[model samples]
Target: MKLNSPSRIHMGLIDLNGELGRVDGGVGVALDYPNFQIEGKESSEIEIDFRIEIDEKDKENLESRIKNAAKNVLDIIGETGISLKVNDAILSHSGLGSGTQVSLSTGKITSLVYGIDLNAETLAKITGRGGTSGIGVAAFETGGFIVDGGHTFGEGKDKIDFRPSSASKDVKPSPVLFRHDFDWDIVLTIPKGEQVCGDREVDIFRKFCPVPTEDVQKICRLVLMKMMPAVIEKDFDSFGKVVNELQNLGFKRAEVGLQKESLKGLLSKLQEVSYSGISSFGPTIYSLGDKDTITEISNEFFDKFGIEGEIISTKANNSGYEIIK
Candidate 1:
């Protein structure tokens, strides 16, 4: 079986304050490009191959993720033997939901090889994903614009404190509150830099969380009253306004504050020309606007700053992943 999964932009985390009995609510969009495509077959032993060009460091990390996920699924199914060939790759830790996409794709492929059916959430649980944010998991299951209601908070609840997905293992994915078709042109900029993860990510969550309640309220209001309506109505301007405003609102503000000077400058440059913001713990900045204008602005910014990265002009993937048997 061959499977392809869409990559996603984690617009922002909402309600990190967790005063309202929930935490880590999220808003995001799924993209059509920078996806993962892999083919899996029943085999005598677990094996993984990458057909795409990638450096040794990235290849080793990618292989580890795939092997770990496959092993987890193999244990569950009481079966052996799955061979996976990665035909395409998503850059890891670039704020493109690459880890979740890679893990879920690996788990899904492994389960299918043994004829064990599972949804993304179940696969997520088995693979130890979707603990903090559901945006990535939701994007894999059903693409387009998505909002998740977040996990229950407090002692003995889904979580007791603020943490990133990698640290919040065993917690289930948050509930998706709203989903709608998003057909806007998007320009994705993946600037080369140190990506935040592991202890640093956990420290950020620990330090700034329970973000200001007012900011959380503002984000909720924007998502509910402005952003959702804008997407449903295809009001690019309204949606773009929310996108730009989110950068300074709540946890997003902190995320942006931690970016390197170069990345921060690039985001500022893009926002001047289009509605732009960082995606998750990013180096991947996304802008919503005329593809040509955003592309030109990004190129100019790169040229001026001598930054190295990739620019992808793509659209929302409303239909999610596809599988060919």
Candidate 2:
């Protein structure tokens, strides 16, 4: 089986207080381009190969994840294995939720090849993908604009702690709060910039958690009132304005502060012509505007920096992954 999974941008984290016994909330959009392509077939044991150039560490990590996912499946049914290859994958750890997409894709294809009848959520449970943001899993199952209610935070199983999504341990996936078909073009920019990963990301969470209640409230209002309404009416201007403002508030504020000074300046420069914001940590900027104008701006950005960068101009995906035999 072959599968194509859309990439997702985490627009922003809605709430982090958890003081009101509510979990973190977030909004995201699925992109039609920069998808991860995977192919799989039954095998005696789990195996994986990436058709793209990736570091040895990434390759080893992928192999381990695939083996673990397959092992979980084996525990469920009888013994089984599969051979899988990531033919094409969106840039990993550049704020594109690459780990979740890659893990879910591998799990889905392995299940399909073994006739395990697994769904996206179950696949995530076994593969440990959606610990915090369900946007990626939801996008895999059915692509669109997605809002996740986040995990519960009260006591016992419901209780949660402040941490990066990847570091949160033994947590179930967050629930999808809202979803709708999104019709908009997104210009994804991945210039060479400082990437937040591993210890750096965890440190950020440690420093910035329990974000001001006021800021979280503003984000919730913008998302619930402005963002959702704009999308329903296909109002790009309103949507862009809301998304652009998100960076100055909530946890995003701290995230932006952690990036290099040059990247911060670059993002500010691009905002003049487009509704732009940095996706996930540093470096990958998301811009919304007309295709031609977006292309020109992206080209100009590369020219100005004189460094090779990727500008993926794509539409918002309306549907989920396509599984082909």
Candidate 3:
């Protein structure tokens, strides 16, 4: 079987003050490139192979995710083993939500191999993802501009709680509050810098979470009044304005402030000409508006810094993931 999953860019985190009993609301969009692609078939025992070009250190991590997903499915279905291979992969921990895409893709592939058809939500839960944000899972299932309502905050210890997806043990993927066929060209700027992931990500969350209530309110207004209507009406100017400000509120504000100085300067420069924002705990900056303008600025940035990056212009994926037999 063959499988292809879209890469996700977390546009912004809406609310972090879940201590007040609301889930962590977030927004993001799916990208068409730098995707997780896998082609695998049944084998005697469970194993995974990778066609890697970016880095070799990722080999073990890639293998482990696939192995863990296979184990979870086998435990439930009573299957002895299965084989898998990753023909391609997304960049890990670049604030692209690579982990979720890879994990869910592996689960989807394995379940098909074992004759168990699982939904993206099930794949997400069983593989231990989508705890905090559903955009990644929903984007993988169906490529679009998506906003998730977030998980519910309940009373019981075992009930839903506000926590990072990585920390949460088991939880249902958040429901999609809204989804739309986003019609706009996007410019991606990936700079050479540190990525927020693993323990470092957890630390950042611990320190900056319970983000200010005022910022969260601003984000809600932008999403509800400005962002949604702009996309619906195909008004790029209004859309770009909201997209530019998405990182100004909640946890994403901290993410932008915490960027490396050079990256910060680069983002500032891009903002001068384009409506832009950082994606999640990003080193990947995405800009909307005139594609040509963003590309020109990004090119000049790379030339001046002498830094190499895989910067490209792409569009939104309007459909869901594909599974080919």
List of clashing residue pairs for candidate 3: none
Tens-place lDDT per residue, model 1, 188-275, is 9888878898899999999998899999989999999999999888888999999999999899999999998878887998888899
Decreasing lDDT order of the candidates: 1, 3, 2
RMSD of each: 1.0, 1.7, 1.8
Q: Rank the candidates by TM-score, best first.
A: 1, 3, 2
197-229 per-residue lDDT for model 3 (tens digits): 777777888888778888888888999899888
Residue-level lDDT of model 2, residues 1-325, one tens digit each, is: 8999999898888777787777666789988889989999878877777788876876777667667776787666675678888788777678888888887887777777777778888878887777767888898889999999888786685445777667864677788888999988788878764568878887877788889989988998999999999989999899999977998999888877777776777677778778888787856888887767766777786787685788777887779888888
| Model 3: residue 165 alpha-carbon error in angstroms | 1.8
Report the error of model 1 at residue 139, Å: 0.7
- For candidate 2, the lDDT comes to 0.80
**For this target, which candidate reaches the highest TM-score against the unseen true structure?**
1
- Per-residue error (Å), model 3, residue 198: 1.1
| Candidate 3, superposed: residue stretches over 4 Å from native | 157-162
User: How many backbone clashes are present in model 3?
Assistant: 0
Global lDDT of each model? Answer: 0.91, 0.80, 0.81
